[model samples]
Target chain A: SQKIEQNSEALNIQEGKTATLTCNYTNYSPAYLQWYRQDPGRGPVFLLLIRENEKEKRKERLKVTFDTTLKQSLFHITASQPADSATYLCALGHRDDKIIFGKGTRLHILP
Target chain B: DTAVSQTPKYLVTQMGNDKSIKCEQNLGHDTMYWYKQDSKKFLKIMFSYNNKELIINETVPNRFSPKSPDKAHLNLHINSLELGDSAVYFCASSQDLRAISYEQYFGPGTRLTVT
Candidate 1:
């Protein structure tokens, strides 16, 4: 069975520092991987998508790296702030339009 | 204006009662999905509809049914809901899953509480 794993433990980082979250998968070769941010009492919002051929993608202060060889993707938030605190999800997209999601990693930015 | 919206943000009902959650998307997308987030906060896909046709149906119980009257609307109906059905249900939409861009927009989510 295919599985997607994100850090189950919450990540706590100081404000102004960079936070790096990881997503690892097995038994699947997804064409692309997507990241989403979910706040308390709210649904997840799309963040970024990185392709199998792409090494890295950036948007504002957010960065995503996909390493198909390792079947892992890394999401980074630079100069993180309290407002950036949320649970981030990673999803793997198959060619058949199937999207499987990880449990998500909760990041807390402490002041 | 909200791109994706769900009705009855909070639903409280007794076990064995039937309920329904409605979803609508105004982004003119061809795909809509239903996802359930459990108490442990694990999100999983339940059903997906494309162009008002059922495309992806996960390993959900037969007690749950999804209806898409139009491409922009997908509604979830739960029959004889159980205590295990207590969770948050989210509706999402995307232009097309197989399109060049596959970003999904999510609704505010409807929290279902079965006591």
Candidate 2:
């Protein structure tokens, strides 16, 4: 079965520092990988999407890198703030209609 | 304006009861989906509909049924809910899943607790 795994433990970072999260998958080759931010009691909000061919994508202070050979994707939040604290999810998608999501990595930016 | 919205933000019911969660999207999207987030916060897709047509149905119990009356609306109804059914259900919509840029917009979610 296809499996997507994000950082299982919560991550704590100092304010204004960079926070890097990891997403690794096995048994599947996804066409695209996406990152989403989900606050408590709220639905996930799309952040970034990177295709298999794309090595890296950036948006403002957020950056995502996809390595199909490594079967891993890295999500980075630079100059993170307290407001940036949330559970970040990694999702994998194929050519089909469905996409699978990871359990998400809880991030806390401490002031 | 809310792009995706769900009715009954929180539902608390007993076992063997039947309940429904309603979802509506005002983004004029063509694809809508239902996902279940369990206690471990693992989000799993249950069903997906494109232009009011069922496209993806995952390995979920037969008690859970999804109904889409139109492209903008998808409702989930669970019959004879069990204790294991307690979780947060989310509704999401995208322009078109078949398209290369398939980023989903999700609703607030409905928390169902089977007591």
TM-score of chain A of each: 0.97, 0.98
lDDT of 1 by residue, B30-93 (tens): 9999999998888899999989999999999999999999998999999999999999999999
The alpha-carbon lDDT assigned to residue B71 of candidate 1 equals 95
Give me the displacement of residue A70 in model 2, in angstroms.
0.6
Runs in model 2 deviating more than 4 A are none
TM-score of each: 0.97, 0.98
**Candidate 1 off by > 4 Å:** none
Among these predictions, the greatest TM-score belongs to: 2
Pairs of residues clashing in candidate 2: none
Candidate 2 chain A, which ten residues in sequence have the lowest lDDT sum?
A94-103
